[model samples]
Target chain A: MKILAIISEFNPFHNGHKYLLERAKELSDCDAVLCIMSGGFTQRGDMCIMDKYTRAKHAVSGGADCVIQLPAPFAVAPAEIFAKGAIKILLSIPEVSALAFGCESGDEYEFFKAAELFIDESDNFKTIINKKLSEGESYIKSYAEAFEACGGNRDIVTNPNNILGFEYCKAILRAGADIDILPVKRVGAGFGDGELKDNYSSASAIRNNLTDIRISDNIPPYVYNDLKYSADLRGFHSFLRYSLFRAEPKDMQRIIGCGEGLENKLKSLENNNIEKIIENATTKRYSSSRIKRILCANALGLYADDTQNFLGADLYIKPLAVKKTRANEILAALSKSVYPVITDANGKGLSAEGEQCFDKDRYEFAVYNHINGTDKKDYMVLV
Target chain B: MKILAIISEFNPFHNGHKYLLERAKELSDCDAVLCIMSGGFTQRGDMCIMDKYTRAKHAVSGGADCVIQLPAPFAVAPAEIFAKGAIKILLSIPEVSALAFGCESGDEYEFFKAAELFIDESDNFKTIINKKLSEGESYIKSYAEAFEACGGNRDIVTNPNNILGFEYCKAILRAGADIDILPVKRVGAGFGDGELKDNYSSASAIRNNLTDIRISDNIPPYVYNDLKYSADLRGFHSFLRYSLFRAEPKDMQRIIGCGEGLENKLKSLENNNIEKIIENATTKRYSSSRIKRILCANALGLYADDTQNFLGADLYIKPLAVKKTRANEILAALSKSVYPVITDANGKGLSAEGEQCFDKDRYEFAVYNHINGTDKKDYMVLV
Candidate 1:
């Protein structure tokens, strides 16, 4: 019995995630599927409109064998760390044969090439890259230049999903895991776009559409219930709210990427204008795009110094569904597997440790929700 | 008439401000008082906890001839901008004689000495300060060292009020204003220590001590109505509940001061780990004390880029005691003033043109209140 492992935020479990799930099953040709879900926060630096458990239930209802948690930190982090953290949990499932993800590149050939260059850090490329950076070019621009110098194509680097996909590929390579990647072209609208068109619209667009009644076509059924349920979870936006109230100018100067003299410039603010302070503090010396990320991280209580290598038991098998007729077959396979399988997150298996782990993750996700401007009731989850 | 200009947040007219008011009166012997109050933000880089109108009312109730807004940008700024912004406003008030402030070295003589040295920015002292700052020492430390090196035998830099007092003097000298200095000793608990002793308690300590109690000895009688009247204006901790729910690792980077690549670290988190994120993110490079401020600022929607310049007005005073005899005194003052003053911010004063300006100021102040962890209602108010 081949088991497919998928990690997701689901947030509201829109068409994008739904499409990915269906495609994963088709490609892996697995009898059963496993999913590790994010509790509240998503990778894009905003709160999930829905709670993880509700989204998990949807995953099971929509078509999955089992559902577990990917935790909030891994869920909201950048593509590389997110992939590494999630993969760590998936690799533990002894029966899991493949790890599937939606890749923008449609194929792994170029993705792997880019990943190798980034990780290997070729000396010839580094010299040129450093020169561009010393000229006060943005890091993103510098990296883009490096990719060009290496004769790599630009189309792959410019796409958001492609970038993340490359990082995901690198993560798998670094892990030296046996699990294979099932790369597929993403079939959805891009993130942060204002409108929702096809069934698979971007999460940002879907959320924006959700605010008005007109965008219902973009979301799945029961999304309202899920949104209402997760309304109290207190996402990252609320964390920004908290951070704004508690921080001081002198204190703000200490965050990484804040830069020297930037604090003094920020300190020069007169209004309660957070955006202005950031604009004034950010200059050619520091790209606004990079600074924005650091600022968002600080607002959401995410920063660089907190790196950790703690990987709990390698395999985390969470059954989303168990056919009553085939229970015996699944049970036999579970018993013979070398990795531990978590049948019940609240009871047996990893429930004891998982419960404690999940609580902390949920709390942070709640703050993320608030900072993203979701209503208070919108963040709380029924689960 | 000789008028004394005072800059303040007056965030609820606490006793600390009252002490400063009385001291300014006695020291300057000014005929009138002109207070430049921050509308939305404060020096701590957070929003004010109350609306500017209510705060202005409290200021007027506590005692002031006129109250003008410091404007949003200057209100939420650091000490230098905050000081400079307020100074410009006070000096613009033609009747102003001097600026009175409270300092740790309640002794005027010592404060003046520090102020004189600080304003001179002598070559020798500047060199010493530059040398110390280059070594990564804190500005406070650098200032103290430089002051001593300048042949000034004062070690009052660590004192919060004295430090501000010196900056205020510096701002005056820099502006070449005719205003003199009136320094009074602080007679309250220190800032952010959470200590409470009789009537002498820091605002932070008072708030902490009042945690669950409806009323406390520390709160003034006049401001009691405000606490009683306002409905559930969520506090910073409560907002954190909302923020964590929405924010992702990337969102944390958007807040001012989240640094050290901590955003990526927090992205690895799961639910309910807000406290852990704070603990993990803080280190030798980032202190918990500073992080708290950043967290608060983020929650309030106050960003470094949003800083504004008030030009001169900090607030447009609206008298709360219209029925009392003080109304005549206030009305008389408003009629003769060059800048327009509002009696009712919401009802009579908010014309289309006035509304535009008021909205801008109120919007900025609202953001500030978010940072200060105070409940704000009715963008424009009658106070």
Candidate 2:
């Protein structure tokens, strides 16, 4: 039986994510669906739209067999590190046969071609990219222009999910993984769209207008009800502000993804609120999402060295949620996992780095628990 | 010039404190009077009623020629260390001729005899004290009984301020300092009295009844104005709770004064609020003040080893406030002092332990500033 794996934030399991899961199962002819979902923090370097366990429960109720946490510094990391972290988990499990992801273009050949060009770029390709970047083109824009300058497809790297899909392919190629790739076409508005579109509302749309907008048509009922528990960047503002204020430049530069005088800029900022700090830190050189991710990473104590340790490999498997009916089969498959699997925060068998990583997760959860009036012990979701 | 030195919390700078200053001038005929005040954290290991700078300003304006901070872990230590920290500062300067303190019984002879007994405790007296402690007598009770058993004065340790006066004498005697002792009878209801007594009020009375009672008669006009800016422990609850949750047992045990199985009990506590934690931690062996002190020490990162380094002497002299008229005179005296006099939080010339101790003060002020919506850079008080 082939097992299909998906990497996602699932911020709230909407109809688009639902469609992707069903399509993944059909294309891979897989017996089980395994999702490595970003917990508490998201790849955008912002907090989860809702807490991890609620989103995991939605994934299970919507049709996932199991959900594992893609723990930070990967959860709040850049696209490449996020892809590497998720792919590393899949690489460690031999029984996991394929890595499926949703893309707006849904053309695996286009993503493969883009990944190859971007990864195997020569000195000529690098020079064009550097020249474009030096001209103050945005990071993604420069990448797109550089690929186009190299006689690659201009239209391939335009969509957000397709960009992520390309990153996933690059991560797989870099790791020399044997897992097959399955692409499921996204069936809704774009990933960055902040408006509800017919029956396929974007996660951002569902999150921003949570109180007034009825998004039941776009998301499963479990997810709709879990909307009441959704969180934003507000709750972490004061704590992050204090953490940033107490942190010196040297202390901040070690935070994963903080560089290029960003730490100096961050130290000089007058704002303690996350939104205002992000606003102040964002420049042409750094985007808002990138700054948000750096702030979340610093707040969670994720240093560059910690991220480097798990570049193309995972140290542990931390299960966030398990389908109650398929628990036995999932356990049987995971029994042969190459790394230690942790079901709870205090998993005793983790390596020193694994322990440190998990401890950071627990500490972040403790902060979340304190601010949101939740408890850390009840983080596991069963459906 | 016979300069008079006083030690005080002056948590709100009540009229009783004024009485001590006038009485000290009469006794010592001092050219100038100086006060060593606790910073953001007080001797009981709690935040001050107001910011340290504000309190220092009140002290300087009220009558003190200059006000210096007794930086933590000294400011928040128990009686012996508190006395030693204060006396060490006075001992370093030759111009400071005497140590004046408020006492209840007003008997200098009894205080002198008790100080001699405590400072040079005989082997037999030590054995008796240990036996009493082993028999489960309280610390103060054991000390009182041991002194009585050793045929020493029974009346000296009966009053709280008298006991503190004896500790001061003991510290001076142990250090072999030439400083004379001056005792001023407390003109209030009593140190622990919770009721308003004419023009004098206990700090507890003013703090606890700030809402309903008329306290203008009890405190100086400047202190009354500063009352508008007073803060309690409530603001620090969530941050401290998170700090305690993040702290391991070993980490907590390092916090100064966290021993005798206190760290174990602290780790086992379910409450995060300072008041609730203090309530739960209080037992027959420990008082509420001790628990509050422990919690403040832990929150400020004051460790057991930090306390051990300054067991008998302060590492630096930190001046918090100065009267404009006497500023030059005080600066002249401090120039030839045995220890470094630090006027700012970022004092460069300090011993390792001194730096650690002052850093704790600044950090505490940072928390205070964060919670109370103030700034740390504006901490110096000038009258």
Best by TM-score: 2
Best candidate according to DockQ:
2
Model 1, docking class:
incorrect
**What is the alpha-carbon interface RMSD for each candidate?**
7.5, 3.7
Candidate 2: give the clashing pairs: B254-B303, B256-B302
Tens-digit lDDT string for candidate 1 (A32-99): 77777765556654556665556766777667666666755465566677777777776656677777
lDDT of 2 by residue, B142-240 (tens): 888989887777667777778789889888888888888888887867887888767888887887777644788888888888788887455566556
lDDT by residue for model 2 (A106-206), tens: 46666777888978897888898899899999777888898888767656687777878888889888888777888887777888799887788788887
Where is the poorest 10-residue window by lDDT in model 2 chain A? A370-379
10 residues in a row with least lDDT, candidate 2 chain B: B372-381
